[model samples]
Target: MDRAPTIKDVAERAGVHAATASRALNPATRAMVNARTAGRVHEAARALGYAPNSAARSLRTRTSSVAGVIIPDLRNPVFPPIVRGIEDALREAGYMALLGNTDGDPERERELVAAMRGRQTDGFILATSRRDDTVPGSPVPTVLVNRRIDGGGVPSVTADNAAGVHLLVRHLAGLGHTRIGHVAGPRSASTGWERYRAYLDAITSLGLDQAAKAVEFAEAFTEAAGHAATLDLFAANPGLTAVLAGNDLIALGCYSALAELGRTVPDEVSVTGFNDMPFVDRQRPPLTTVRIPHYEIGREAARLLLERIGSPEAPTKSVVLPVELMARASTGPAKPQDS
Candidate 1:
């Protein structure tokens, strides 16, 4: 069997001391070696095909350079971009990401958290944090993304849902949408409550007490829930002329309900959604929504987690990313009453 290439082999080929070769290969020590000498050592390593054993290096450093990322659902379009951001950021930092999907179940989340902890992951980027969750007890550093925990001061990166909802409501009000309805997300999640409260605040601030009555809550962050909520809202208040959906999926549900009721978007009842997920623009009637930087939030969360892992004494932070309103085909001025 052929012996694996070694630093000595690289040094012999480059006509340099083995110690010099080792230093040249080490990222920390490379600057100490002359640039020309380092280049030569690199050439020799290439010729000898020397590859550092990451497993051995990790063992020696007592860190796996692996971060665990937990998501509530993989099927949610909002998560894919966020995961990409996390993976890209972690890869750039020479760390690996281990992804786990909890299907929005607390038990599954706890199980995944335990498995990740058992694997000796250096840290975690959790996108499934519930207000009552206990997963924050992990000894390793953790950063929440797109979610918040109650009383856990862990660092987090999340979209400003309240601000985004406020923007949406203000936009609707400016368009003369006095009879606006809201299809809120599940009450169990932070985004849900934050958005719901923001809706109330925005409506109240606009001095539209009647408009606030149009708000309804969905059972989950799914299209079915959105559809059911929209149906109930329409049944409860047949005069509503505009609807604010919790997310894009919920907005799609609104679309479904509108179709079943033979109502056209924008022309009959304008609808808006939050979280501008991919392909929303290409829908039959493009969704007007709040655009949260989902991917950037994930990337920033991973970056913060890595920083926390490196400097455990660093102060915890809560990063609130901004959101923008995307005016599209789904939202327009309210239809004329007589039309």
Candidate 2:
């Protein structure tokens, strides 16, 4: 190439004025241009391999043009779409995204938060909030995704856990499942704690509280924790007709435990899970789970953080997205033999 492509070059190629080209290339000002003209300018800029100098832009705008995204476990399969949503939203605002994984460790979370802030991130989008989360200290704007801290200090977007659990219990009851069990996640997490409470409320509301002998709590949301908890619950209440798992990973542990006892799912014991995570439908029998809008949750969190970054004095807001029941082959009517 003769010289690095410039805004003038982009304007010449796109047949628009330099001011119009600049507006099209800038995220904050792009909306002021006509859609057709903006599209043409962007296409021309891309064809010429053009990117504005970050040093110059930062000096002029006093912004890093980057956002940090923190997730608890990237291997969980539920975070890819959420991260994608965050990235899409950030890109449209002319900000690059940086990701940090905690692997479910508070110390790691603190280190990552500090590292991102050191890199001059304009804000944070966190997917690792716990019940009493205190890792991400008060600095730049932060938004919690897929998780939240009760009596919230930060903006967050999450699915309605209590309502989702109620839907699951009602479905199982409607199918005649009475001797129901629960494989709950760790109590330290807001999701784990809230979902477990929801399960209790659900059973009590239906007058099935007496049938709650087979409850177990996984130390974490991992498969191993679920497996151990399920086995423990089954040993105590061998005749349980159904189980409500804290999340899909824990439900998988339930599957492993039930398999060891030679129990066929939905025939002897029906299983239900939360989060309706990716590929549960492809399991031995499709899993019946509560569906939350993961991508939308991520997008909402990003928007909230952007809003907070723009206006630091805004009151903290919580966005509770709705959930739905996905009844699949994993649940069935309770057998008469259970009596």
Candidate 3:
């Protein structure tokens, strides 16, 4: 087997001392060395396939060129784009991201964070923060994306969830859907809790408070949970003519449940989803949903994490972007069947 190239090899090839080659290869100390020397080191590195050992570099510079990205569920199409955005932004900044999935488990999340810490991640970009999370207590810098808890201790970048919920409810109300039910996600998640509360607020604001009896909570942000919660909602409120889903996955579950119950979307009941994920437009009825800037959320989260690492005392804040309502085939004017 071919031997792996080392810094010593780079130094010899570049005709410089090992320390000089190391400085030239590092982003921080590169400026300290002469530019011509740095250029020679770079040329030698490429020629020798000399990839610096990240662990060794971390020891010398007290900086790990690695960051951690925590995702909740990859099956949800919305997350892929968001993750891509983060990867793109981090790559441009010359940092590498290590990804972990928690599958909506707090214990799993904590374990993953601990493991990533053991690996010496400089910071964390967490998209899976539960409403009650110990992530705020992480020893390293942490930036939350897509979700946040109550305390403002950590930086966050989330979609305008409240606005999105309000828009979904308002659209259903405008369609004369007085008996509108909601398929809410798990209460443990801020996205579910906040959006569900907004759903209540929007319904009450429209004088549809009497119609809020159709609420059902999904066990998780998953199709199975969504289907189960939707079944319960329909059973409890058969008069419901419109349904607001916590997310696209839950919305899809609602679709499946409605199909088995022989109800046609936008005919007997109109269904609306949150987070206009990929391929929703190609569904049997083409979902009506609220579109959050998924990619921008990721980019903003990465940028915030980088900034917080640079300025640790910069007054932690949450940035909430706007949302847009997408009207489509899944929602329509209320049918008289509810009456």
- Cα-lDDT of candidate 1: 0.85
Tens-place lDDT per residue, model 3, 123-204, is 8999888788766436688999998887658889999989999988888888888899999988988899999999998989
Candidate with better TM-score, 1 vs 2: 2
Q: What global local distance difference test value does model 2 have?
A: 0.87
TM-scores, all models, native as reference:
0.84, 0.87, 0.84
- Taking all chains together, the TM-score of candidate 2 against the true structure is 0.87
Q: lDDT tens digits, residues 305-333, model 2?
A: 77777677879999999999999999998
Residue-level lDDT tens digits of model 1 in 157-211 = 9899989988888888887788888999987778887888899999899887887
Q: Which candidate is the best by TM-score?
A: 2
For each candidate, what is the lDDT?
A: 0.85, 0.87, 0.87
Which regions in candidate 3 have their CA more than 4 angstroms from the true location?
Answer: 1-57, 336-339
Residue 133 of model 3 has an lDDT of 72
Candidate 2 or 3, higher lDDT? 2
| Poorest 10 consecutive residues by lDDT, candidate 2 | 23-32
